[model samples]
Target: MKQPHKLWLRSLLIAAAVSVLTIVLNTLNVFEIFENKTYDLRMANSAKYKLPCDEICLVCVDQESIDWAKENYNWSWPWPREAYARIIDFISAGNPKSLAFDILYTEPSVYGTEDDTALGDAEARSKKVIQTFFISENDYDEPLFPVEQIKENAAILGNITSKKDSDDVIRRARLNYEYNGTVYPALGLAPICLTEESIDYDSIPVLEDGTVLLRFTKSIDDYLPYSAKDIFESYEAWKNGEEGPLSPEDFEDLYVFTAYYAPGLFDICSTPISQVYPGVGIHMTNLDNYLTGTYIKKIPGYVNIIWLVVLALFAALIVALSETCFTRYAAVAIPAGLSGGLVLSIAVPVILFNFGYWILLIAPLSAFIISSLVNIIFSLGAEGKQKRFIRSAFSQCLSKDVVNQIIDDSSSFTLGGKKFEMSAIFTDIQKFSAFSELLSAGELGCFLNFYLTKMSDIIIDEKGTIDKYEGDAIVALVGAPLKMYDHAKHACAAAVKMKKAELELNKDIVNYASNPKPSWMEDELYSAFKILVANNKTIFTRIGINSGEMIAGYFGSEKKKNYTMMGNNVNLASRLEGVNKQYHTNGILISQATRNLLDDDFVVRSLDKVRVVNINTPVQLYEVLDEKSCAKEELIAYASDWEKAMSFFTSRDYQSAKIALSELLKKNPSDGVAEYYIHLLDDYFLKGTYPQEKDNEGVAFNTEDGVFKLLQK
Candidate 1:
């Protein structure tokens, strides 16, 4: 090789060595810095996966279930003891092996205070949750457990927990735990072995190293594994009419394995459902699957690693194909196939074969596999026609990764792109035209470039892909490039950070006369730039976010084109940015789509229904909180009240709407959205088109005649 080539090779070798060292150090740090995660795995199995044996599940005592039991038993209060007793009796009747209760008797009982010892004694014995299993290590390095009364009656499952990873929340429960000189099975295992002859701890299949293959069983045709409530409710509804709850038969043979499924009530939370499961219903589903021979997808560690690498390769291929073929169709089809293949791979083996597995392909894998396939095809000259489509589909909204994901997956690359769900963000510097006139071209270029760079950086940093840069605006996407785990969160983060950066930039410029007093000089410069005009200089930008289905990908004329998204959702996103001004807010306005996807991460206050130029119907609007200190409950209450008032105003229920608005103002004295809508409501109810009647939903109606009229059909 030439000297240059030799030197480059040497440098690459050195870099690789350094990278390896860095990776090793990072892995070690990951172990040391994070919480221990062994128990998390156990919890995960308990929540989602089924044990080898049947009959291990948590019967959810939902409000509906409780209500049904109460009416029949003439009971006024919800009690865990009665349920426990019923479960115990049922288990005894079934004459199956073991029984475990995933509950904790952490506190003393209140039922003991009653005269009838039946209620009190039952409550006390219900603490026999310990009866379900043996306890895990109470002291470190020593496998230890105490055999108590319940342990004698049924195989007690010690619902023990270990520390979690510091950076994440995953606990891997130890299988075949050892305590002192004794080895004990997990409560789940213990119960199964005791109840059925099919499972013998000593005889069960095990790896050469003694570990049984643990896996998830999933099926596409089946919904998320059903909880006890689903079946019980169905049965109950069949017996009780439409407005009914569970019936007596619903409780028959209801061998309940009670545990937490409710957020505040349950002990486990790692299911695909909410971080805090609503009830322990997952346990019941798991038990049902365990008994009936249901399973999901699983990939062993070594093989999973291989798949991960393959997917990465696929992702790389997608990028190449997109650049080469330049067609949207190829990009789209590839990813679709990969995602489908992965789902199928996971479903078929577990659901059909009665084995366990997991769709080992991570989000990135699906993104890469499909994108690579299509992009490869599109890159070919014959298919390069999709190039214009590529630009059109993603130019203004997606990040490079998302673009690459689209390129990698033929499914995402389409000339006439199909509708897919995505989160769109539109940001515009308010009054940019006026701001530009105030400065020379050089000054304006510097000003615009600086703002755009900062905002775009923020967006990219928050995992958003920049779609394009319009004169005074920038549009981007969060879910595309790859459907992110938390696109809304990333979008919200970008909006907040961009606004923050603007304020800091202005602070330094405020004292510099040569800088010509940064036009967006409001307290929150970035957010106030176009909207916060100061001394005829407010060039603040407004941001709006809407997440929903939109026709995305490259679609345009061959000669002149770009990648972009076009649809009602995208339009709504653009409309929302301006909506901040109407609502007199500084940050993002979210749609219902955005709301449904969120859990506890956001604090949003509702704004009035927007009467945009072309849209006839009003949409619910919200102002997302930038700080955690913002009271979520109070904000929700206030916003809900305002929305109620808006409803009254829409229906021309002037009196009711006014009352609601006035009530909201009482809670939040300077609420801007409410105030503006209140004025509009008066005029709308009195003069605009709406029925003058007060009902539960006080609403005023207005008809739009412009661009919005076209959408009515």
Candidate 2:
């Protein structure tokens, strides 16, 4: 085979694989939302196409009709069955081709048996009336049909249930429903069966599942329905030989569909064309589609695969046959061309849709996108020498994600700063200086690597950007390079996970102490290590998160600049990590800005209001409880008492808060957070000051705002 043929084969294989995956995802309903929206857009854009154009009309039991009935007949809704009898009489006089009542009379009328008999007589008089049946969820094999008298007198009984897609949008019209081993036509199908249309009932192209892709056109405004009140007036006028808004001529050979449209009485469904669409209008649209023979049908699974492969091969051939100049310009012109072509592929479904067929949207589009990306990758490989040099230079300094991002689009990265809302997390080991003395320099380096690696994995897994690693600390940001709406939530979750991870890492260290030392280790060194392990001396880290607008970019000389964040918001996050020390807490602490972004699923409790050094504005802090460390029951009880104590403290009732904290300490004696607040209360009441601190940055409890101000860092 020629080189072009090989390229085509490769492209075909890639498309086939992606197409199959798309099919699997689609079957699992992963694309249901996107597909429904796409269908709605198509319906809104398509030209208005009417079926039985001159024959079909809707007689809605609108609010006006209901009010008219109440005043004229001296009765409210659930009106006597005789009222429908009169409607039947009026519509029957017009000699319509089919009169479908999209209503169900499943029980005897409240008026009397006489009213039921009267309605039954009228239904019998109209040879074209189609009654509706409801398929109850409790039993699909046996349908809930209209009352026996009405059913026996009707021309045909049809199912009224239109199955909605998973997204609650009705995109398919059920053609028929089977009950007790007998298949019955649907409400929409009933009219087609009764009309003089040229459809072969036995051989229509209905799916084996008895459904057809519902093709909607324009909007309900396109088919202006005649009001039921107007039709009743016309009937009275015709009887009295007087002129009215409606005439018998309007109903000649018409397929009239009557349904209640009074809000709370009629079924309101969501559709592509309209969010709150009337269910009756949907049935009318389905009926119209059937009359015009324009119902959409799905392309078979195998046929979809074939279409994908053919399109992919064609695209690949276009690229492979390109001359050297085309390949040289492929970097710019080819991508632009491919983008335009991908957009144009949308027209395939749109055009084929007119012919009553639907092509899987995601499959072809995925093939186009993936194939283009593959071709670019292959082209890069063809220029391996230069590309490798670029990758090697950037790979060392930047993360793999940032490197790939720059490689893909270098213009996105710039030295100029950009301002955006982001969530920043700052973490620090509780006592890093002590770790240096505990471990030799080499062991400390290895330990730090292990800790950082575990923390980095959690951040990256949450799609957070690792800003930089300060010694014994990790600084990360969410919502950069790629925007995330829930950046704050992600950052907070990452903080919680890091705290949990530290606990697990410490446990691993304790477990590892049992392992034998290296042959080079002397007895004294081994004994010292064993003693450290026996004492359960392990690292504890504190995390803090804050969310606010920040400026992010490189800041340094051109040769040595590093990409990171710098702003008041970023500093607040750093301060929060340090504030954990003041609380004597070794867990995650989040500023109010971050707390506001958290959903109800996170377990957190308000810690305090504090003014960190250099920032006069008071920030509210919350402690995010670890799901593993704290039992749910204990956390709930602790949070209740903790909140009560803080409430008293905030109101300047130090004695009450003291009593509350002391009571809480009885149950939760090991809670450092509670003990820390008690100590503050004791010092303020006795010494007239907080624990010893720098003069300018002295920790002072403010009575006016109930905020603890730290005057020094």
Task: Please provide, for model 1 over 34-132, each residue's C-alpha lDDT reduced to its tens digit, 9 standing for 90 to 100.
Answer: 111212222243334443332233455545445555665555443635445554443333333333556544323334423223323432444323233
The CA lDDT of each predicted structure is 0.49, 0.71
What total of clashing residue pairs does each candidate reach? 131, 2
TM-score for every candidate vs. truth? 0.37, 0.53
In candidate 2, which residue pairs get closer than 3 Å at backbone N, Cα or C atoms, i.e. clash? 697-711, 697-712
lDDT, candidate 2, 247-327, per-residue tens:
777777888888887644576676766655778777877777766766777778788767766555545544554423365
Highest-scoring model, lDDT: 2
> Which residue segments of model 1 deviate by more than 4 Å?
1-59, 65-83, 94-98, 113-155, 160-176, 196-255, 260-264, 273-355, 358-713
Worst 10 residues of 2 by lDDT: 689-698
